[model samples]
Target chain A: MRDVAIIGAGMIPFGRRDEDTLMDMLAYASLKALDDAGLGDKSVDAVYVGNMGGGMLQRQTAIASSLVDRLNLMPAAAETVENGPASGGSAVKNGLLAVASGYYDYVLVVGGEKMREVTGWRATDFVATMTHPQAEYPYGITLPGMAGMFTRLYMEKYGVTREHLLAISLKNQEMGTLNPYAHVEMALDRGGIFDSPHAIVNNPTSADPLHLYDLCPVSDGAAALILCPLEMAKKLAKPPILIAGFGQATDTQTLQERDDPTDLKAVTLAAQKAFEMAKLKPGDIHVAELHDAFTILEIAESEHVGFFKKGEGGKAAAAGKTRLGGQMPINISGGLKARGHPVGATGVAQVVDIVFQLRHELPKNRQVQKAENGLTVNFGGFGNNVLAFVLRRVQS
Target chain B: MKKEIAITAYKCKKCGKLHYPYHDRCLACKSREFEQIKPQGNAKLLTYTAIFNLPWGFDQRFLILGVAEFENKIKAMGQIKADSVDQLKVGMKMKPSWEPIRVQYGEDVYGLKFEPME
Candidate 1:
């Protein structure tokens, strides 16, 4: 099989975008990526759209076909990928395999979710649909509820505290201010959100242990990438970022079924497979973007991915180890906490942010100096499904 | 008459791995054959949370939910009979009951419920 490389990446700002429809967001991001690749008059071989709630929220389906037609890219094969929150990563994986197999020379992978169009309650219910129909959904278990339980367990077993969680919340939200594309631009203050007398009102509990700030906001946005053979990418003007390795894994549908509920086995397996295929260890990674849908997840995934020892991830964040220019700068784009998680768009947006870092195009604040390699973890269905990718900047 | 827990747990005949809510194949050994069994005795609370921002269907301000492991090792999720998460603790004993967890179309949906047992 041939190697796949990303030639171009594009993303629109993430927030409550009431103006753009799901198809419009996908088409806009795709056009930006196509233009970024300098494919002015050229068309892709196929199109893959990643979406989770088009039919549920917008009453629209077959988004890939709609996007291809909207972008005037007729005749190209079109397909939509849905894997809960990992839809974007799954779509990219499809595009990568298609290009690597030599079946499609150029593939456009776009992920977008117009979640803001629906009420928060509806969105929460929609996301909860991923849970076990019989065992979990009936219990009214939302994602935050799952995270809250996980957080409680982690605290009891690993000694993780609210202070450690606060560190990530502050750090990521602060980074968000520097990110123009971030949905939450306001930086959180310790006094206002935690220490002050009015803290109760400021940061009310959404889930028992996790507060409002601990969870990511519902957002509407889209991101796209243009992928081709590594050989073909070299001919392009922009430096190519090779998809060095990728891995996808699944765990039990219900967390209670796992022997150890705190163990995010799928995350460990997926990251391990990606690292093994890349022939690189976690330490070798220059920058990383973890799926931080909840603050506790960032800590848990950081440990599961081998960035830190188990039980140490929370402390690491509290000590500034995961901050930009620190030991391993994570989520320099503000992560899901601040950048906003538009489910389908998040996986693609993570890669797009990394591409900017690897390309050395971002302002010094967000860019990792002379970064060579980056990694991304896109989590789905709680920890039931996960995907990991290792990207390397090809030195010209 | 006291309501009996209606849940059925399948034990993998090959590997002895127990499963709740019925799995087509055993998760550990992938055995096609299994011994059906009922969750026996009181359970231990494994984890729990009180969700404040509920979904569209739930009208209550908050709902307490948890997972518990029974004497026979049949683990399942259920609504916790507690005023708050403070009333629940991991590893604490819990009495499991079959009762209405929610209402759908004016019909009660019966599921597992756990009450703390001192």
Candidate 2:
């Protein structure tokens, strides 16, 4: 096996993109990555597209092949990977291995989801299709519903409070104001969202215990990355970010099947494996991006991934330990909370954000000071499937 | 439509372990042979959520879903009966009852739901 490095990363602004088709968004992001790689007219060996609801939402399938054709990169091996919301992470993992094995020198990985084309109810139902057909979906369960239950349990067992959740919402949204590519660019005032007399009317409950503000927005966007063997990456104009380690794990399809409902076992296992392969501990990571589809998820995954001790994640966030310029800053890209979650695009966008941070290309306010390493956790199917990646900056 | 409220599980002939919502083969021993067995009624709730925003097919304004550990310790998820979401509590003992859990295909879909035991 050989080492693989990300030579280029690109992202389109995330929001309700009504003007672009799924293929168009994918092609644009791919072109941006190709341009960033500075490989004018250079051929890519294969293309992997990560998408969860292209068919259901756009009535389109075979996106990878369609994208390669759209970009005039025909004859390249094309495949679409779908692992629910973690599809992007899964695609990158495949591309990483393909390049690492020396079989493919250049692999283009792009993830995009155009969900806003459908109604909110339809999108909610579409995502819930990942749940147990007989046990969960039949009862009208959605991702927010699952997160609400998990949050309630975490609160009772771990002593997490709404105040802690409020801190994450406030911080991420504030950071969003600084991120041009973020879906939500407005900052949240504590008084408006929580302390005001009209708070309940503004941030009504979507799921009991988890208000609307606590959940990520359903977004439409795309992100891409170009991967190649580390040796080839050395000659590139930009500093390469090595894919040091990646791990994927699976749990019971239904959260109830697990012995402990609050425990994200897959998150813990995948992070541990990634750390072992990277030869770096969580403490060594200068920046991190956790799956924050729900604010509680960011908190739970932080602990499960060893960034904080169990039950301490919420407190740590409240204390600004996970904010920019703080000790071990996390979600400096604003996270899924404010950056938006276009399911398939989220995982790749996370890596792209980390790449920017490691390369010191982000604005000073959002950049982690002298960041060298970053971590990302992309969760799928209510923690049933999860992927984690550890990336390091290579000093040329 | 009338429905049975009882919960049925599959017991592996080779390993003697049980499975809920039954699988094709025993996860423990990979035994293909299994026998149907009804789970014990004593149950403890793990966690639950009251979803106010109803999905496409569900008719209820709010759906109360619960995850519970049965006497056999196998975890399962199902809708729970409650007049209000506040009445539901984690770790509370409950008994199963039969009712229409939701409206599907333009008709009520009957399923077993747990209720706080009197």
Candidate 3:
């Protein structure tokens, strides 16, 4: 595969945009990315969108075609990629492949979800569709409930404490406060987590061991990125972020079939592949964006991807190792927990943050100083599918 | 009418693997040869979720229960009509039971659920 580079990245603020339609948000982000790249809509050879619930949310199918029409890129091939919450990452991967394979000179990748427009109960149903339809969905295993189960087991098996989970939230919120685009940027203390007004009102105990604050909010937003071959990328307005390594893997969809729920083998394998391809080690990475849909996920993911030792992620967080300005900053965008999880838009948003940090364009407060290398890990449906990408700043 | 909770599964004649919530083809061997096999013995609850919120078309009657390795190593999710969320715990023993999930569009759909084993 030819070397592919990210020429431009753009995102709408991660939060509830009740006034904007899904297409409106996508258009905004895509236009911004195109303009940033000094390209026009006609330059895009194809478009790949990551959307999981256009059908459930708005009863809108054929979303790819709709985007193509709305963007006025009629001649360009348009497709929608869905892999549960990992939709964003998968779409970005496809766009990377398109550019790498020389199939297109330039490709547009966008992820958007208008979740808050639907009723909360309906939103639950839409998210539940990620599970086995015949078994899990029929019984009602929402994502939070599954995370709750995982959290309880991790605590019992690994001695992870509830306070550890709370600490994860507190730290992410601190990072989120530094992030201008984060959905919930307000900082909170451990006591405030369980007793805060937000907790009392919106975050009632949805599941045992997981309060509202411990979970990622249902949000609506969009993120977009422009991909091109290495030769063309250097000509763009901003410094190019090279796709150094990319890897993806899948596992059994049913959680029971997995040998160990505590160990995300798919994530481990994907990360290893990415690191090997990049010829870089975990220590070489300066920054990271992990899929932290829940607090426990951040802990589990940090360990699974070799950032911290197993069962030591929580302690590392307690020690502030993963915080900004620490050994390796994580979720500087507040993560899904605070940045808001718009499902399809999450993966692209992670890449956007990486681009900003690598370009030294991020607000000084959230920026990681001299961030030259970055990684993004996007997992679909509780580890059923995972995609990992490593990006490096191209030295002029 | 109080009915005893039973665990039902389908065994593939080709791979000799058991599948929950019967299917036409065996997931293991991808074979059509199968027979209904009642999973014997009880299952340990690997993990569970107490859903305080119910989705649309679901009754506000019970908490959503997601159990792993239940009834022949099958993962299942269903409405668990237990007395309280405290009654649910990871590693707790459970028995499979069939209950009416909901009447969707005037059709009653029955699904397999798990209740705490005393």
Candidate 4:
């Protein structure tokens, strides 16, 4: 297989975009990526769109064909990939495969979801669909509920605390303030974060121990990436980001059936596979974009993915090791907590942040100096269906 | 009404795997042959949650109780319907009982809930 590279990446600001349609957001980001790649729409050979809740959120189906038709990319094959919240990452992986396997010279991958268009309660219900239909959903087990359970178990078994989880939110919010594309740019104080209005209302006791501030916001946004063979990418873009390694894994969908809820076995396996393929270790990564849909998730994920020893993730975050200018910066793009999680768009948006970091396009205050290697973790349905990728900056 | 709870599950005749609540096929062996089974009363609660909010159709009457390993070693979530939420804890022994979740149109959706087995 030929080597694949990301020539360009773009994302719409993550927030309530009721004024814009899904196609409008897709077009905005896709056009930006195309422009960044210095390629016209005619250069694209195929399109892959990732959307998890378009049918429930927008009452729209066959989103891929519709987007291709709207973009006027006639005769180009378009397909939609749905893998719960990891749809975006799945789409990008598929696009990379298509370009690498010689099926297409260039592939444009886009992921978007207008979650804020629906009522907050309805959106929660919609997101809850990702859980096991018979076991968890009927018991009023939403994402927050599941996260809370996992957090409780992790804390109990691994000796983590609410303070450790709070530190993650504080750090991400601080990094997000420097990001122009972040949804929540304001810095959050510890007291205010534990007592703020949004936190009080949204973070209310969804379940024991996990308050509202511990979760990510419902957001609307879209992200796009242009992928092509390494040879073609070098001619089009300056310093293309090479996809060094990609790995995906699956776990038991039902939380109860899993051997252990606190341990993310799928994520561990995927990361190990990716690292082996890339001939690198966790220490080689200079920056990371973790799927921090909840504050506790960032802590648990860091440990499960081998970024830190088990139970040490919370201490690492609390000590500011995961912050910018620290040992290894994480979530400089605010993460899913403060940056916003638009389900389908979250995975691609994470890669956008990595590309920016690798190309030195981020604001100086938040940029990781001498950053060369980056990794992204995108998971669907708690621990089920995890995708991990390692990217390296092409040195001239 | 005398409150009673039991661990309820759908047992697959082909694989003998027990599943909580109800399902058409056994997740373990992908079998359609199954029998409704309720393990004997009183089992340990593996974990739980005290939900402050209720979803659609659920009135603000009780806190949701997510119980595990009740009688049949099956996990399920249901309203406590108890007097207070302070009584719940991890590893607490509880009994499973039947309660009306809500009336959709005219059909009563029965939910499996757990009560303190003191």
lDDT of 4 at A225: 94
- Judged by lDDT, which candidate is best? 1
Off by over 4 Å in 4: A195-203, B1-37, B59-62, B82-85, B103-106
Candidate 1: pairs in clash: none
Writing each residue's lDDT as its tens digit, candidate 1 over A268-381 gives: 999999999889999999999999999999999999999999999999999999998899889999999999999999889999999888998999888889899999999999
lDDT of 2 by residue, A1-396 (tens): 898999989999999999998888998899889999987788799999999999888888889988988888878999999999999999999999999888999999999999999887788899999888876777778899999999998999999999999988998999999999999998998898889989988998878899989999999999999999999899978999999989899987877657687899999999999999999999999999999999999999999999999999999999999899888788988899889999999999999999999999987898898899899999999998999999999988
Can you give the lDDT of residue A247 in candidate 1?
91
Each candidate's chain B TM-score? 0.95, 0.81, 0.68, 0.67
lDDT of 3 by residue, A1-396 (tens): 889999888888978898998888888889888888878645689999999988878788878788878888888999999888999999999999888898898899999999999888889888888887776676666777778777777888888877778777888888888776788978876555565565566556776667777888889989999999989888766899998988888877776656677778889989999999888998889999999898888888889889988999888887888888999788888989888899999999989989988998987778899999999999889888998999999987
Give the candidate number with the greatest TM-score.
1
Provide i-RMS per model in Å: 0.9, 1.5, 2.1, 2.4
Collision pairs in model 3: A139-B77, A139-B78
lDDT of 3 at A82: 84
Candidate 1 to truth, TM: 0.99
Give the TM-scores of the predictions, in the order they appear: 0.99, 0.96, 0.92, 0.92
Report fnat in order of the candidates. 0.78, 0.64, 0.65, 0.36
lDDT of 2 by residue, B6-59 (tens): 567788899987777778877678889988876666678888888877667765
- What are the RMSDs of all candidates, in order? 1.0, 1.7, 2.6, 2.9
**Candidate 3 local lDDT, B50-89, one digit each (tens):** 7666677776744757564554565555556577778877
Native-interface RMSD of candidate 4: 2.4
Rank order (by TM-score, best first)? 1, 2, 3, 4
